[model samples]
Target chain A: MKNNNKKKIKIPKGSNILEGSRAVALTVANIEPDVVSAYPITPQTHIVEDLAKFKADGKASYEYVRAESEFAAASIVVGASATGVRTYSATSSQGLLLMTEVIFNMAGLRLPIVLTIANRGVSSPITIWNDHQDAMTVRDAGWLMFFAENHQEAVAQHLLAYKLAETLNIPAMVNIDGFILTHSYEPVIIPTKAQIKKYLPKYSPTKGSYLNPKEPMTMGSFARPAYYQEIRQSLQDDLSNSIDLIEKEYKKLQKTLGKDIATKDSSALIEYYGKKKAKTVIVAMGSVVGTIKEVVDENKEVAVLKLKVIRPFPYKQIIKNLKNAKKIIVIEKAISLGNVGPMASELKSALQGKTPAKIYSIIAGLGGRDITKKKINKIININSQDTNKAIFIS
Target chain B: MKEIRVHGRGGQGVVTASEIIAISAFKDGFFSQAFPSFGVERTGAPIEAFARIDTNFIRTREQIYNPDIVIILDASLLGSEAVKSGVNNNTKILINTTLNPQEIIKKYPNLKNKQNSLLTIDATGIALKILGKNLANTVILGALAKQTEIITLKGLKQAISEKFSEKNQEIVKKNLKAVSIAYDK
Candidate 1:
């Protein structure tokens, strides 16, 4: 009977075909967060729905909370984490924007929650498509942010998110390009339960931070002007300090799950591909990185720098990788309204005095507009050294 | 890498058909990726889904600008602009219609002079006869497997069973039969 039961529940060892959302949901199940709460939104809907179905089918051992709104969903996880247990939630686009107030609160409260942002464009004319605008909106919310380039990385990053979040006692959000990564079906190898358990153990919060009736401690209390600045400074310092630990934990995960399962880099913060001496280097994040990689392979003179981690910025790493390039092109999906592309602005700021390479900001694929290979090829051929304006590539 | 684009109406399992192709390719020991075109979907509205199969890992996530093969699940979408968008002279087209290839060429003259390979099968009739419904997505895949050597019928059967495994065993049986019947045609 034991052998039969084990055989029935055994997961496939190598890569299995799975929809991206289903893969993420299965990873979340393996992590076995104490509570899972979310409000359904496009692209993100499949993930939470699968989690709920898993709970209903008795495949998962977590509290699945159905919330009325994204605010309520974010709040539910915030409240759940206050009791010192792992919690998770997911949302996209407008749904994420609705959780804005609580999102800031979750970070300030320093709850180690894991949230998945199926990245999408914010509404103007209204769209339910893949973009980075949604996650870019929360770049300053004090949460550790990571973007995945493909389904395999998406699955591995979720495991890494819980580890990073719990260790730093800071919330983490993994950004997956909505509909692009969320809706795509690909061959991905989800790590086994034993592997994930060995990599990311149960969450153990600090004794004094959580709320307990017996040892009653105050959390999220009001701070006067005297201490508020110091509190903000500490959060900033800790986030920037996590740069080293992120790489360390990623290497340990690679060793635990085998290097083939996770990405090859010792530092999962950024992935660099193509020739070391390539004159042209393209920098981007999210699913677009995959497309760039394909293009980079065809064009031998170009390279790609995939930004996996957004917050804490990875300033030194970006400079180290792009220092020798003659031209650095930053193609992105979102902008700061009046300012340049979110990532482009950061690159300009990071590489201002360090490197002599000119940075070009090109925006494409907003509101799910297709960034075809032709468009990327054209962007690559742009010999113009103009770095002043953001070029909207059609 | 081989890219395929599928065109059909909403609720016609267009996405599911692409996913099946991807899964079948995976079962055949190849890397595959499939995704739906980002759109505001509604019942009976035109929609598109894409799949790519390769001996190595598929890295690109962009929409398929030029497809190697095109599958149409509904005959009504045969000559639609969306159907003709990415197709080129080299594209092999499979359609779910009762019309023969000559009849199809008569209706759409542009497909006549091109080097495109056009294959037509009554997938809807097969599906309706076997499954008692107009769900021609899986049925058309059988024709796809017959025409193009991209994926095998055995892989398609396995993919069908795995996809519908969560549902009634009867559904899995009927879908497999529908695909098999369409394959024989």
Candidate 2:
């Protein structure tokens, strides 16, 4: 196994065919998690099942739990973390919604649990495809949300997320493109077990207050209205400050690997392809990012700012990156219900109080709607003002 | 800057094939990169995967245009519009079909001017015959090795042996035979 890694760089080496679910399992197992729990849901089920297999195979040591519901799953990880042990769990649209109550609790208590929101469309009519409403429903749960641009990012972010969560003492939620990145196959360069172990300093919880007879302590107690606000404010402060911790962990990863992660460092302001002198730029994230790059290349002078870090929102970077653009289009995979795409609204925040450029809203790929490179090129072709009104289902 | 396109549907092992092919090139002492296009479509949906192999680290992160070679695992994708997205003067198309290489090239005039190293192997047919399933990956891969001469025959065999199951080893042997048959035909 040692010298097998030394083979040439260009020739394709061996590959273990894996779905998105398998990719998640292998990453968690490599992290050597202390606790694993999650409720089975489509697309999300394979992740937990693979984790259980890892536990049974004794390939990794951990207490794997088949929780009754997503709520219990989140609470279980929180409880495990308060005991000063690293823990993890995952869920899809409905299941993630069910865990929203405890999700806030996990953050308030500063438990470092990493969970997956396979980003499914939450519905009254019932759809299992892809959307961000499931995660957007709990966007304010005080948990750090990171959307994966692809399965490789989904896998890479897990390792980084665990380290970040542990560093900041805050839980992390990774939202993957449901059936898109989850079910699809991709060439992911998984860190070796030893490499992962070396890069990730084993998670050590600094704060430990357990609810038990021997060391009995109240984790969440009833507080007066005034005190509640103070605690919530502190929680908010901790989460916002966690942005630093997130970057710190990512920087450490870059030092060890040499390539900077888009989610960390100066890679925050999205990306563009084609001629740098282009007057138009479109910004987006996730797997569709590959499409944008392709379109920009085919139609020169088109650039894109691909957002890898969505939590901190990188306002200054967004403004500076697109200052010269004639038209800035913000495309989104998940719509904001009544308004436009998530990126569209974010573009508004980044552009406010500044010399404004023509900003457009292109909403598409909600519930896994197909957004092709051709469609993106078409969007760029549309007149400058057409962007003011939201373009849905592109 | 050589581009290689891989054609297949979801669950057919095209992603794995590209990866294995890329890694095999890397093992043979060349620079390589492989990634899936990861379309939003579901299982059985048409998909495209790509790889760049050279004597040095790849710089371009864009899709293959003016590909040096195109590997089609499922010949059925010939009907899809994406098939014509980037066929040019120098493109070499290796499709897995029973039809003659010249005949398939004749039908798609865009690819006619270029060399159609079309390996008319019913790889899907061979995979079903040997694996008892529709995994055209191994069969298509064997054809890729023989046609491209980019990697050694032993290297391709070793790569497949590393990935396939015990039962599929026999399937691999049949697939290799199918590839040899495709190469000669």
Candidate 3:
């Protein structure tokens, strides 16, 4: 697609079947961010490229900066956000890893910037595939994290993320499993520019919060050891307390942009599917939850717990939902290198002596490997017999 | 629900064809999902893309194992094992080659004498003649629309126009002509 011929078509007010990246880009354009600086990486490449194209064709009003590196891209967003502008950036895998330092800086400085992580596997053997490793690497960076099951939810999350992040003055990362969700095409109802303007409004920081000419106050100055602990505690406290605000913003977006825009009958943090009293339950995040939900639909005795929010961990919600299950299976795409799956480990810590459900960690679909129905059924079959060991489905 | 798998080389716009199929299905008031299963990141490398059309919402993100319809955009890939991997007797197979159905079966005797419906077209020749290029991905969709009622020609044309509408209108015109020529063939 070249940008030489710039002709606009009137998109009807309904679902437009589009690739996930394109839908997201359109939504971002409607949101009307002040700056979008990103270095392209596969899966994430389409998104930045689309946004760049929009800027080139005069469809987007934001300044699309062609950054030299991911680090520079992250730095650009941070700088723009500090000056009280709604800024956006996106990356995947190694690109994300490169942006780690700036990622934490954005959060610590209390910049309400939104970044999209087209989640991908990390290096070592060098694979360009979908996995949770990249997102999991910065799980505790104090940024509000969200995992979308599909394109619609992804669009909804972006709309809601901006509202919540701006309200709480915190950074956010919306993680879409690379390739799986980013490359897939589906019918998505992106909010119109008018709808977004009415919903998100404009970015106006509180007095003295941003770097303004009238208010001369040092920003991101070195915090001494005396106050650093409390500052960190404040971020932790706000992130944990933002649970209620997230739900509130989610409901607001749903009410503002029809019910179809929201993930059907689910909270902003988690979504439960399949039989409520099923003996076996599978817990996972990202697009894999969709496959598990399909398998659960056929099996009468299995359920699925789709974790949408990973930053807050949602441990209390996870425990509240899985208290009755006889067996719990934690399926994840990323492992903690030497230890168990990050999500499984967190679940065990959260559910210790809390639920009688025997928890099993099953790691599969590493480096873009397909998670088929047969493999899901294999997890079901393995759960029938008791074993505390983690199962890796090859 | 109907599952369609497309087999082609990287630069052949295999992923775009699958997306157009999904868009056409969506245009016809069906829920659809389309995605590609990439191998290597280079042109001419064999790749597979999939499209699923269902009356209900599509939830599964797994690659298609047993597709009801299979499309081959490159005749050179006809000899690959992947082309016939999950094909059953009832599977509808479309190939972009000049060989007729009988000639194709004769060349690849292992296609098994089953009740499978096979259709072939010289997509390359048609694309070269009309579009002045060897991009036959969209041309194959016209044959698919004509032979099978899986997707309507009107819906396919609308989807094609929408896809290429961002590009030069001349390209869209030529591609639409190629599709019509293949449809009439």
Candidate 4:
């Protein structure tokens, strides 16, 4: 009864089939951050638990702080980051909501703290599953957000997130689909310590950015009416300008690692797959893009534009990618209540008067509902026949 | 691509079974992915996990709606509606039970057919005899390897040994014995 087909197989070194949360955690540990503060929440609990295990096993040398609450966790990282040390934390759903006040402060003060938002559904009836609602809630919190489409990207993006955050002095959050990405196990190539050292050098803070007791300076100060608008505007401008820096680091990573880590288009923030001139293109973020790509590969008429970076919303790249398409379908895991999906609304506004493609918004996979290939194909079929402004796939 | 769905209650190592299958497939030079249902996680609650194995990379993140193979770790869950869903004519049912395969086919008349294959193994009994516990996940995996031929028994043994390498060597050997016993059955 034994499997007669058994043969000798060699597992390649440095490659492992790792859970997405564990991959991200291991990547964070490889970066050798100074401190990690976190509180356990469903879907996100494994991340902090893994980090704690890493510390216990002597795999990492960072100070691990088990905070009382998400708010306290956020505060602890902020303090750690302000004192000129690389810091990390992760949360989801209510935890992300609880840390909202500190989330803003971390960005407002330009603390360069990196966090992982294991994107989950916001609760009232209570659900712990995949959705973008949690991350979308803090879309305007001034933190740069990057959505990973899979476990490999989830690991690679953490290294990129830390590099980008420290380089720009802006807080960065990597949004991974809770349970979907966080709980899933897939093969990933983890960067070695030597590779990390060569790629992401030691953290040396610029003089004005760090909170040194020797040269004490005020941060998160109360701005007067005259300076308030300017401060907000400056943050906005800096976020927008970060696209260049983000692309630069991505390219540098490609050169250093000798692999194309980012999208194929060196300059584009959005990754396009399928025929470039396909009449119909589906636009999405996070893990859903994987499913879309599978369907897109089968259909010659369909294409996909995956949004890698959500904040500093890649308007120009998105518009450019969809300009020639006759139909554009925006799939979202979260709805904006009274309005359409947050992403769909943004896409519509970005495409206003810019492209002739009729835009359709489809809200699917809310609170852990599966977005199967059949559902995606159905959406494509429906959108092809006639334009639907907002269709809820239940 | 081969998709598999595992049904068992919480604390039954259902997720671990899927992971081991995936790891075994990976060890055999195939791309594999595994994930749990992430439902209410209370112990004894019906939980499911999924696995996909293919020659090429698996890009889709969707749950396996039409699994080629379904492994039932808990025989008590056989009558549940959740276990009945997504089963088609070509689906293979591998259950950890002492009942005969024909008996199971007769019990679930809707699932019986000429094309479909229903398999049963006393994995729980084997686990209790060899490992002194009711951990049938690895034993069921051995039966799955024999039925599907998706991963080799050698691959499964390697994965099981590596998984329990941190634990006592005696325990790892006992688990391997359980897998061997279930495979022979």
Candidate 5:
């Protein structure tokens, strides 16, 4: 007799220095998704390569498909997800832009697929480098977006993203800064299979949402103007209502990993570092948060409020954290052309009537440009006074 | 924290060398990071990769503007201006070349009076002899382990074994022998 319960699987413990792309790929493999369909792209290439190797080596049991283009890759995952299976795919920059149509359709159908965005700069001159512009393009595509600050967060967030997406039946996008996070290697703690199994069980779609041949139903059908607005409103409401579940899953993960990663607030969306009463606060996301935290550690008067979850925006928490600061500096990698930085614009809207802090928008580290500690200090020193336009740090 | 930058050609395993150094550092109970400078990668083009080792977690993602140690995997790259940009008076440089360090310095007058530690080893000579290929990455890694002592020779060998065993076991034994020969030199 085959005794499945007696079989032992040795999981990796302690810390291993892993590149961000490889780390995320290994995490996805461990989760044991049903299908992994992806096309190769730079910076994002290592991820799919590693996953393909895993499948080839028999380390993971999943149906691996090599799609022809990013568009086909996204469509394949969507089709696989409609058959009631956990599916995944990754893309960046132009590849991501090519998949925009399928991305919108997947989110509209409310499929619980998880996609990784190795955030890269959209090109005219052609750059295979790090930035948030690729992800910022799909900010309103109805996907739950989360940015990782480091390799550890990159691994942790993928695990959390799968669980959250499955629970809410909403697609999730895990963004890791290209090259900066995807190529860079760092020590990360990988949880055991036993722990993951306890947290994330086998994929079983919600009661009647999954497609069945016996009970065929149409999804993502065109609706009249009157019904379209209501459908959009329902999606917005579902995304807004996911806050509680996101917080719950974060708490559950904290318990499983035996680490304190969640914020003190009920909504684990905002992460504040340094002094609570800091007069100046720097707001940013993704790998740049590491630099900001290092500077905040050295200076007593400055603090950093890192937004882990960027989609739901956490308007109340953002205002609450930055209300006391006299100066708010929002440093972002992506800027909305002819307007302000996307994150800065959002921060300004969040603090419209709530705080009296003077906001300064600074754009840095675009196209793989290095954001050193010295440059961060320079920004803090020079931007003490108020400015109207966005400061371009060259 | 100690920062090391490696200079080589695109097909010379520059990025893999950095990754091995980082893995060795991790094996020795230190936190490490390795990454290549983002560039248009093409065979025979000049390339650079970086690695950092520390007792604590490293947070900064900036390129190493001032490297503590610089390893030149291709002697031909010594003529490029990028090779000399980040080196300082206190930097230790390890070059893979057939000529002696003093002779090379004499040939290039610019390197005559720099207050830096310059060391040279015929890594190609050794790699061609042992591995039957001109892959000097592991040979230079052994010399680096000996010069910096950031990671022990055993740790480097273990990391190399882990990486190479995935493809072929015979290659692992040959590379381990190459590391020992380079360390002795």
Candidate 6:
């Protein structure tokens, strides 16, 4: 009756059995960071606590900084990364929104910091379910963004985010469902230190200076109007350039792990499932994409496309992926207030001056709201029964 | 598909109960999915957790508007919004109270049909007599095992043992006793 299963079974060929938060923790720990920081909040708390325990219990050799507020949390991570050491931290809803100012500041300096976001509902009604608003607000922060469809992707993307961020010199935000994925238990195939070390190349920034005191340089000098334009352009360039590096890392991962079944397509920007038959595809981001895939697969006509990489927008790839379709269902977990969902609106602009497939914007999940399987079926049912309505299931 | 809906407040272990059942199913090689539906409601506020086990894929996402089995962790929730939302001739009602099946069928008119079965057991009493707290989850779980052949006593015992430690083995044994008592009494 006693659990004697603690010999650390090296779980060869790592299973995607881990929960989202634990996966994020394992990735950050694997990166062998210099500093880890946070102030605990529900959902987000487990991530920091797990990593902190890993650090404090002599499990990981790193500095674990428990700050006072979310503001301090971001600032701490930013300072550590500025010194050219790998930095990691996590936050949610109010905490993420609080750290937004410093979040942009970290990206503006072109710091390759990796942050894990437990997607939670923002305030006004005060609920603790999943939503995409917290990460959506930071979409324009010049950070390479990614969303996970489930626990496995949530864990896998955290590792990929670090690789992408460090390579592109553009920070990345990896968002996941809060309590739905965070506090839930599932089997995870945890990689051994030796295996992860082989896949993840050590952090080596050629240009950035460390705290040597011999070669000191100003990091945050306010540039004059003439120089500001070019600096902003460089940030844009770095973000745009990350698309290739993201795919490169993904390919390397696929090669190392016998290819990704969740994202089998060569380009790792998005994942697709179902009928591969219908021109009508429902595009979405975040955890509910799993439910959407189930519904579409059952219907036997419609297909589900998951937008894994959100920022840098995967513009050309987006147009290419949805090009074959005559009609598209752009379902956004976070709404854009005045009109269509965020991704749909962005795609609309990208695919401007040409209207091949009529896009129906369905903004269903807001402040969590139990966006179950039936609701998605109803949407698809309505789409089949009548495609005229751009539905909003709020 | 065997659809189960557990009705209880936030702290009554409804979700945990559903998960335990699902774990039992998974160990038996059955595909199962278990999830919970909660609101701004805090502890002691009514919450519903669901489980669906099927030989094939289950695409119907509707809240088991009518579940094959309805577990009442707290008898008070029998009057709650969710209880009446989905109860029918095919539904089997398992409550944590002293009232016998016939007495419950008499008290509730909706359960008048011959097809409906009310299986009542003093789950709270069983828990208090064994483990000490008002943990009707284990007792109701026992009643569930009795009312239906979803799992065997040995299989349920192994599931409980897998979930808990050596110290909690007594808890598992007592729970198994609760199941047998509820079924026989």
Location of the lowest summed lDDT over 10 successive residues in candidate 1 chain A: A1-10
Alpha-carbon runs more than 4 Å astray in model 5: A1-13, A260-268, A384-388
Q: What DockQ was computed for model 3?
A: 0.48
The predictions' CA RMSDs to the true structure, in order, are 4.8, 5.7, 4.9, 2.7, 5.9, 5.2
Fnat (0 to 1) per candidate: 0.69, 0.10, 0.60, 0.61, 0.51, 0.04
Q: What is the lDDT of residue B75 in candidate 5?
A: 88
Better of 4 and 5 by lDDT: 4
Residue A36, model 2: lDDT of: 89
Better model by TM-score: candidate 2 vs candidate 6:
6
Residue-level lDDT tens digits of model 4 in B17-40: 998998888877777899998844
Which residue pairs show collisions in model 3?
none
Give iRMSD, candidate 6. Answer: 9.2
Model 5, B1-185: lDDT tens per residue?
A: 78889899988889888889888887776778898887445788999999988766788787888988888999888777787887888888889989787887876666776525787888888999999999999898888888767678988998898767676888999999999999988
2 against 3, candidate with superior DockQ: 3
lDDT winner among the candidates? 1
lDDT by residue for model 4 (A1-394), tens? 1223563333434568888888888888888999999999988989999999999988889999989999999999998998999999999999999999999999889888999999899988798988898999999999889998888777777888889888878899999999888888888877877787877999999877788999999788999998999988888999998887888888887677545232234542678999987999999999999999999889989999989898788888888888899888899988788777888889989989988888888899988999999999998976344443568997
Angstrom error at residue A375, model 6: 3.2
List the pairs of residues colliding in candidate 6.
A17-A187, A17-A188, A18-A188
Q: How do the residues A307-382 of candidate 5 rate in per-residue lDDT, one tens digit apiece? A: 8898777787788899998888899999898887899999999898888888888998888888988899988876
List, residue by residue over B1-185, the lDDT tens digit for candidate 3: 78999999989999999999999887776778999896333698998999998776798999999988899998888778998888887789999998887888788776747325788889999999999989999999999988876888788899999988889999999989999999999
**Per-residue accuracy of model 6 over B1-185 as CA lDDT, tens digit each:** 78888888877888777767765665554545555655223788888877776553333333466688888888777655577566767777778988776676676655556324677789898888877888888667767776776755555665666655345667767766776666565
Order of models, best DockQ first: 4, 1, 3, 5, 6, 2
Model 6 fnat value: 0.04
Off by over 4 Å in 6: A1-23, A26-32, A53-60, A185-187, A258-267, A381-391, B39-41, B54-66, B87-91, B114-117, B149-185
TM-scores for candidates 1 onward, in order: 0.96, 0.77, 0.96, 0.95, 0.94, 0.86
Q: How well does chain B match by TM-score in each candidate? A: 0.95, 0.80, 0.95, 0.93, 0.95, 0.84
| Whole-model lDDT per candidate | 0.88, 0.70, 0.87, 0.85, 0.84, 0.73
lDDT of 2 by residue, A1-394 (tens): 0124455443234333346777788888888888888888865877888889878877879999888888888888877877778888989988988888898788888778898877788777787877676876776778777777766677768877787777776788887877666765444556667877777878754443444567667777898987999988887887776656666667777677444222233442244455664688888776677667767767877888877666656666678778888788878766677777767887887787674577888777776556766678778876745555778744
Q: Which ten residues in a row have the lowest lDDT in candidate 2 chain B?
A: B56-65
Question: For model 6 chain B, where is the 10-residue window of minimal lDDT?
Answer: B54-63
